[model samples]
Target chain A: MDSAISVHGLRKAYADVTAVAGLDLEVRKGEVFALLGPNGAGKTTTVEILEGYRRRDAGEVRVLGEDPGKAGAAWRARVGIVLQGTGEFDELTVAEVVRHFAGFYPTADDPDRVIARVGLTEKARSRTRTLSGGQKRRLDVALGIVGRPELLFLDEPTTGFDPEARREFWELIRDLASAGTTILLTTHYLDEAETLADRVGVIARGELVEVAPPSRLGDRHRAPATVAWRTAEGAVEATESETPTALVAELAARFGGEVPGLTVTRPTLEDVYLRMIGEKA
Target chain B: MIGLAQRQGALEIRQFLRSRESVVFTMAFPVIMILIFASIFTWDITPGVSFTQYFVTGMIATGLMTVGFQSLAIQIPIERDRGVLKRLRGTPMPPWVYFAGKVVMVAAIAVVEIVVLLAVSVGLFGLELPSTVGKWLTFGWVTLLGLTACTLCGIAFSSVSRTARGATATATPVALILQFISGVFFVFTDLPAWMQQVAAVFPLKWMCQGLRSVFLPDAFAAQEPAGSWELGKVALILAAWCAIGLVLCLRTFRWSLDR
Candidate 1:
């Protein structure tokens, strides 16, 4: 598959500090690639460079088959960005803001349909400033997709979303991916990344440490599973195993089936993420 | 490009009109300041020059100041702080189109404020209207040129304000000091020669002097006035300032605060 975004030896430094140091990455077309990192890890810097908002000191970066640094309006039209924050247009209703932004693109989706997709149809007439946090994020997403862009950049898109809202946002992203729009997402929430990302990349200290499928990330699912059960002494015994199903079966036989308070747990993405970040520190 | 510029220009006007507080503050403050100064000094000033004409001239100058200084210094910084500038930076639209749209909107607002104030000064306060149509046209263009200077200067001022709260305070001190030295409140002739020299370096003095020429009679040049208030010179100075301001603003403006 053709790559939507490619970076080679990307290096950006300010004065005496280096933000991105010889970093390399590739995001294939029509894939949701999530970049996870700690604060000051150069995630935002790299994304800004790709968005053409800032010039890099030295790097080779291509977005949507053209060098982003030199791309003009035609290239810009293909890339949609949903930033972490939004502007105040209190006089404008949701429909007005969406339609207004749609004017910037050569070919844009219908404003009403885009609003409906983000589930803001009911609040179409409400002023933007009156919308709740989740609703505002929905509007931002609506504006981002109005252009029918080939590639979308979402920076901490669900930073302020509630549990229910975050889940709904994941659905919206998945639908966009299904429609064949490539996405590059930078987020601090591991669950958000795992839930929506086709593949996850862990970034630490301005370096791409690991990249893999969400379930197989950093031995995340394959790591030792904790198997615990109640013993005859009225206490508990536990053991870590590569094969928890087999261990549970053996325990069931010895305990005559249905062991009391039996529980099987595995290391989650968050567990591995913390360890990776800690090791970098 | 023209089509997009027109559409964006209309939207910018709509956005400005939607915000009741900013519009009110931007238009009303200068008008009120002009009225207060006119009322206080009208009785004390010498004859031959109607305090009304003096007041009208100062009010027009205030209009220029409003559009040029406050619009850029305060409003631009506020908008930038709110992430509006950052959001626009991400779009596919040409940067010039965006700036053109803003300049067009600000010019309109400045014109409306000037017209209303001039109408009230002449119609309500019995101030002398301009003697000829050419004088009126000169008033129109000079105010516009002065406003253009201010808007560009506002863009430059926006770069100095790191936070929105700091923008107003940062701008007011410089504005007041210039107002005093530029003879906006007092006559430049009455001030020290050095003070007059210092005011000449800035555009505000020329803007106010140019407005005075439009409203005052041709015969009034006898009273030790600073040389001729040449229209061509006024236009040239304003255009020069506008060009310099644009270059500086584009060079230094930041989309977001340093992190």
Candidate 2:
């Protein structure tokens, strides 16, 4: 199927709180789709529903062409999930855990290769408890991909990683996507979505607010630019302009030379995201 | 499914062995208790049966409960809170395979625990082993039925506590209360009639009674509350509890506390 995951009018509530309210989404085969939202914005609730870990109150969900809520072991064999704060086998070595999970799938990848792919080859022989937080997360990724799943779900895979570690993890995700595995990622990091996702969907307050490529989110490319320059009095002057280039040219001519401290900037992805989510950047 | 359960069992045993504290505590606690009780209580319960001989059988029953019920109840909740069970549920492996693995692990440990208790009883306390094949058969069925009942009960009880510490608090008091009332620490006939009735409602009392039949002399069966070994009643009660435990496990078992 062209669509690896499809949901229509999904709804879930926890007693008095509505977690995912009438949300709809889709992820095409071989594409990395990122779900971006703040905490308690229904990102995890929606992903868990699609992962077959939670039941929806009202809607339909199909993962890999079968309804996840009623899917059996055969359907489970084709799906991989790396949940938040998981992969803690405190008494077992990394190699042991990875190899153990590989047995559950009909077509599994080599555990050692999976470890190496996640840059955890050196720590494979060490106990999982002994690994650093970042290394443990790498082991989590190794276990996630060992099943050779056609579709993978990564829920906040790099939440606690350092900048360099996050970059390394992004590379690992890119490699998986290149291997033709469809990935559904959830993250609040705007740069991460922009760098990895073919399309990013922003969920806010239990509903999807917008879905588009990062560059085109909220019409970012065509939004008015904020043109700022310094006057002779050493004060900053700024204005919103539809044509920043013309504004800069006019300012430069007015000054009889280059405009001092000139800067022309359209809204960034983060700015648009924060604005869409009703938060001040 | 069998292959996966076997692998899971092997992994579980390895992990259990690696945890030095749990290994020492689960296996050693019963052995230590048997040694202490044997030393302090040197009196005879009847004409030919010393207190050690009678107490050893009770201790065997207690050991089974410790491993099968207490350990699983305490450990499963910790695993649940740690997200171990949830992670396993996400895989292609069936849920029953996880429980089957637990049964395998518990059975292996229970066998070793029984052997060690028996050796201590015979070597140190001079407790006699069953001579007749019929008595041996009694020992086999009682141990198997009791272990299965306790293990299933433990899995069901695991959902009662939200955390490992809570599980320990809940499981320990319940186990201790049953041991006291079920004649593990006292003579069955010496206990009050109401207490005997309460213990009879639970499986541990029947397990202890069945084991006493195998380990104690036929003449000593006179001291039993029923004035006989009552092997049929013991088997029936334990089997009934096993059925009840299975139903509870099917109804109450949870993969995680969050759900």
Candidate 3:
């Protein structure tokens, strides 16, 4: 199937709270899709439903061509999940845990190679509890991919990583994506979405508000630019312009050489994201 | 499925053994308790049977409870809270395989605990070993049934506590009180009538009584409340508990606390 994940009018509620209210989504084969939202905006709830960890109250859902809630172990073999804070085998070494998980799949990757891919080869012999937080998260990734799954789910995989570690993790995800794995990633980092996702979906108030490539999300490419420059009086002058290049050219001609402190910028992904989520920017 | 279960069992044992504190505490607690109780209670129960002999059987039953019931009850919740069970549930491994692995680990630990307790009883307390194949067979079946019942019950009971500390607070008292009423720390016949009835409802009392039939002298059966070993009733009650425990496990067991 061309679509690795497909959902139609999915709905889920927790007691009195509506977590996912009639949300619909799809991820095609061999594409990286990121789900971005604020906390309590149904990001995790929606991901958990798609992961088969939670049931939807209404609507049809399919992952790898089967209903996750009713899918058997064979279906499970095709999906890999790296949940938040899940690599917690305190007494077992990294290799031991990864090797153990490898036995569950019919076609599994080499546990040692999976470890190295996650940048945890040095810590393979170390007990999981002894590893740093970033290393432990890498182990989580190792276990998630050991089964050679066609579709992988990573929920806030780099929540607590340092900048360097996050970069390394993005590289590993890129490698997986290039190898033809469909990825559904939920991240709070807008830059992560911009960097990794082929298309990012923004969920707000239990519904998907927008879904598009990060570069064009919310018609961001066509949004007016904010052109700012300093006047001779040492005061900042700014105006919204649909044609920033023409505005800058006019300002430069008036100044007879260059506009002082000139800056022209379109809305960033974060700005569009903030506006989509109804947060002031 | 069997292959996965076996691998899981091996991994469970490896993890258990690597945790030195749990190893020392789970196995040694029963051995130490048997030693202390055997020494302090030196009086004879009947004309020939000594209190040490009677107490050793009760301690064996207690060891089975500690390893199968108390330890599993406490450990499972810790693992649940740690996301271990949740992580496993995400895999292709069936749920039954996880429990089968637990059973294997519990049985292995119980075997080692039984050996150590028996050695202490035979060497230090002069407790007699079973003489015939029949008595040895009785010991074997009782150990199996008792451990299975306790393990299943522990897995079911783990669902009641949301955290490991809560499990310890809850399981320890239930275990300690059962030991007191079920003759693990005192004589069965000497216990209060109402207490005896209460203990009978649970599996530990029957486990102790069944074990007594194997370890205590045949003549000591007269001192039992039923005036005999009541092997049939012992087997029946334990088997019933096994059924009840299995049903509870199937109904109540959770892969994570939130679920």
Candidate 4:
């Protein structure tokens, strides 16, 4: 399929609450798409439907060229999932767990190589229950990719990682993306979404608000820039200016050399995201 | 699928073997109970049929029920609660393979419990082994059928609860009730006609009956209600339970704890 995933007019509800409402989304093959939203904004519900782990109340969803709702084992073999909670094989060592999961797929990658790729070579012999939260997440990734799936679904993959571990995880995701595997992940952390997603889709209140590259999210790059400068009295003055370049030149000429603390900047992705979700709320 | 079940079964076996709780409570519970019951009671229910010999076979059935029914009922729900079954559901492996592995593991544990209990009874309590090749063959079929029936029943009963604690509370009562009626810790002839009829409807009574046929003296069959070892009836009842349990499990089994 040209698109690894396609959902049109998708709708799902739990009793009285709607989890995914009239959602239309598509992810191209080999692209990293991050579904970002607030805590109860339907990100997980949407992803779970695509993973075929949960049934949709109403929708037309196709994953890997087959309807996820009725897809068979062959279709399932082509998809990998890292659920929100890392899967635990408490009694088995890391290598043993990896090898055991490897038997599930038709064509799997080398368990040792996948474990090393996730930077978990040292903890290979340790029991899964003994590992730290971050290490468990790495093992989750190892299992997700070992199946050599064409598409991978990561639900808050880095929720419990330390800074170094999170950075390493991003590198692993980047490598997978470069290898032409399609990824669709959801996260509470915007920086993770910004650093990894080629395109970010923000969902607010069961509806997708926007889908664009992180740099251009919420018209962030195109938003009015705020120009600030230190006054002669050591006080800072700032104004929202559409023509930040012209405004900076005016301030520089008036000050006779350079404007103090001059910062001509637009909003960060986090700023735009908060504003967008806040407006919708 | 068989290969997947082998790997799954191996992992289950490892976990079951390593756990100190299961070793002490599950593996040791039956043998310990048999030792206590054999020593405490020495009444001869029939001519030359001592309580020690009769109860040994009865405890074996009780032990099988504990592992196959109680253990399975609690373990499957706990696995579901812990998201182990849910995680496996996402994989390419068929869901039945996971259950097949459990069946194999429980059966293995059942066999171990049986062998240990039989060895002790024969070695210490002077319990008799099956005399004829025919009786040994009968013992083999009864063990296989009884073990399979109880395991499937456990899986089916696990569907009644969403949590492991709930399963234990629910499963324990039936097993306890079965113990009394099925003559695991009491004499079958001592119970009323209606109670014996109720016990016959369940697998435990048949399991006990089948074991009695093999271990008890041939003449002791006179104490039975049918006035004979109902080997054919025992096999039929257990096979029917397997069929009914398979249907119940397929209909009610849930991978996740949502329901």
Q: What is the C-alpha lDDT profile of model 4 across B18-117, one tens digit per residue?
A: 6779778788887888778877897788778888888889888988888898989998888888777877877898887888789889988888999998
Name the DockQ score for candidate 3.
0.76
- Candidate 1: chain B TM-score equals 0.90
All candidates: CA RMSD in angstroms? 2.0, 1.6, 1.4, 1.9
Candidate of highest lDDT: 3
Which has the better lDDT: candidate 2, or candidate 4? 2
Candidate 1, residues A1-281: lDDT per residue as tens digits? Answer: 49999998898888889898888999999999999999999898889889887788887999998888789989988999998786766778999888878888999899999999999999999989899988998888898899999999999999888898888888999999999999999999998898899998888887888889889889786699999988889898899999999999998899887888899998889999999889987
lDDT (10s digit) by residue, model 4, range A1-281: 68999989899888899888999898999999999899888888898888777888887888888988798888878999898784487878999989988889999999999999999899999888999988988898888889998999999999889999899899999999999999998988899999999999999999999999999998888899999999999999999999998998899899998888989878988899999999989
> Residue B15 CA error for candidate 4 (Å)?
2.0
In candidate 1, list every pair of residues with a backbone clash: B68-B150, B72-B154
The segments of candidate 1 whose C-alpha lies over 4 angstroms from its true place after superposition are: B257-259
Lowest lDDT 10-residue stretch of candidate 2 chain A = A272-281
The alpha-carbon RMSD over the true interface for every model, in angstroms, is 2.1, 1.3, 1.3, 1.8
List the candidate numbers ranked by TM-score, top first: 3, 2, 4, 1
Ten contiguous residues with the weakest lDDT in model 1 chain A? A83-92
Candidate 2 local lDDT, B83-197, one digit each (tens): 8887888889888888988899999999998889989889999988999999999999999999999999999999899888999999999999999999999988889999999
Q: Which residue pairs overlap in candidate 3's backbone?
A: none
When sorted by DockQ, best at the front, the candidate numbers are 3, 2, 1, 4
lDDT of model 1 at position A5: 94
